[model samples]
Target chain A: TQLLEQSPQFLSIQEGENLTVYCNSSSVFSSLQWYRQEPGEGPVLLVTVVTGGEVKKLKRLTFQFGDARKDSSLHITAAQPGDTGLYLCAGSVGTSGSRLTFGEGTQLTVNP
Target chain B: DAGITQSPRHKVTETGTPVTLRCHQTENHRYMYWYRQDPGHGLRLIHYSYGVKDTDKGEVSDGYSVSRSKTEDFLLTLESATSSQTSVYFCAIARGLAGGGETQYFGPGTRLLVL
Candidate 1:
């Protein structure tokens, strides 16, 4: 079984602060995805990174896949109250099918 | 946002009782997944269906069963409820074409409490 360990399980910051969460694993993945989930709702996909060293930006959020494909990071610039949520990273080994494994999750709270 | 809905959004049940959660999707997606989310555990896959009447167990499938009789509806059944099984359950649909790297859209989720 592959495990993805996420750092800084809990985070609290004032609005406009910048924060970065890291996801590390010993196993390599073909693709990695980031998801954000608000209270009382399921997770929503934020971005997907397929190649090593690839970076994708979504408004204030930026996601990067490691060069080894065994780790990833999510950076939030100028965080806002709406950026507060649980962030999850999932890794997929197979090129097809539904065999994705997810990290524990990073709970972020951005106070206005 | 994916047109997925789960019935009995919140449920309270006793131990040893059978419970069934229903997931309905209007997108007619070919893949559907069931996952459970806990405080420290983000989301653990319990089961998934690739097509009508075709399903498979996931990482945490013990004591849980799933059936997909039609394309739009997938059902998850807990044979005997256990306190350890109490968690938020989510239903997701894969919106990408066959093969991997597809984005999955999730339903609001069903919160279950077993006492």
Candidate 2:
């Protein structure tokens, strides 16, 4: 089983601040995905990184996959109150469509 | 978003009782998953089905079982409900992502409490 360790388990910052969360693992992954979950709702996919050393951006947010394919990072710039949520990183070896193994999660709180 | 519905969105059952949670997807997705969410544990997969009648266990599969008789429905059963099982349960359907592997679309989630 692949274990993903997420750093900065809880972070709180004022609006307009910048923050970065990391996901690291000892096992290589075929794909890694980032998801955000709001209170009372299931998680929503933010981005998927399949290639090592790849960088993908969604407005104000950037996701990077490590060169070794064993880690990833999510950076948020100019965060807003709406950006406060639970951020989860899931990795899959994809050897039989194995269900993703999730990180402990980083809880972000952006205050206005 | 694929139309996914989980029955008994809120359930309160007694320990040692059998409880079933149903997940229905209108998109006929090939993959469906059942996961449990806890405070520190995040979300852990309980079971997953690749296709009709084809299912497999995940990292945390004990005390839970799943069945998929049709492509549109996946059922998760707790043979005997326990306090450890009281948590928000989420069902997700996996569909191909534009660039790679698969992306999962989740339901609103079902909250269960075992006393």
Candidate 3:
């Protein structure tokens, strides 16, 4: 069984602050994805990193995949109230018929 | 908004009762998936269907069953609901192939409460 672990399960920060969320796993994955879920809604895909050491940016968000493909990170610059939500990291083994193994998620609260 | 919709967005039922959730899509995607989200667990796959009348169990499929009789609709059934099964259910669809890193679009999700 593969598991993805996320750090800082809960985070509360003021506006304009910078925050980083980490996702790590012991098993290697072929691809990793970041998703943001608001309250009472389904998760929305933020980005997908396929290659090792890959970095993708979405506005103020920066996502990086580790060189070993066993970990990933999401960094938000100048966080705002709109950034408050649950952030989840999911990985695909590439051999499990494209099924994704998800992390526990990081709940971020950006106070305005 | 990938043309996916889940019915009965919120449901409350007694334990041991049967419940069914519906997922409808307009994109005619080849793959459809069911997942449940909890407080500690981000999202766990319950079942998936590759095509019409073709489905398979997922990581947490013991208490659930799924059916895909048409290209646009997939149904998830809980024979005997349990309190432990209360969670938010989400339906996702993939447009292209199944294992090629295709992006999946998710529905709004259904919140089920088994008391």
Docking class of 1: medium
Least accurate 10 contiguous residues by lDDT in model 2 chain A:
A92-101
- Give the winner by DockQ: 1 or 2: 1
Predicted candidate 3 versus true structure: per-residue lDDT over A1-112, tens digit per residue = 8899998899999999999999999999988889999999999989888889999999999999999999999999999999999999999886334788899999999998
**Model 1 CA lDDT for position B90:** 95
lDDT of 1 at B83: 98
- For every candidate, what share of the true interface contacts is present? 0.72, 0.70, 0.60
DockQ of each two-chain model? 0.70, 0.67, 0.60
Among these predictions, the greatest TM-score belongs to: 2
Candidate with more favorable, higher TM-score: 2 or 3: 2
**Cα lDDT of model 1 by residue, B1-115, tens digit:** 8899999899999999999999999989999999999987789999999999999999999999999999999999999999999999999998863444676778999999999
TM-score of each: 0.95, 0.97, 0.95
Model 2: per-residue Cα lDDT over B7-111, one tens digit each: 989999999999999999998788999999999999999999999999999878999999999999999999999999999999998878676577677898999
State the TM-score of the second chain for every model: 0.95, 0.97, 0.95
lDDT of 2 at A107: 96
Off-target runs (Cα >4 Å) in candidate 2 are: none
Q: State the lDDT of candidate 2 residue by residue for A1-112, as single tens digits.
A: 7899999999999999999999999999989999999998889989889999999999999999999999999999999999999999999888345579899899999999
Cα lDDT of all candidates, in order? 0.92, 0.93, 0.92
> lDDT per residue, candidate 1, A17-68, as tens digits?
9999999999999888899999998898888888899999999889999999
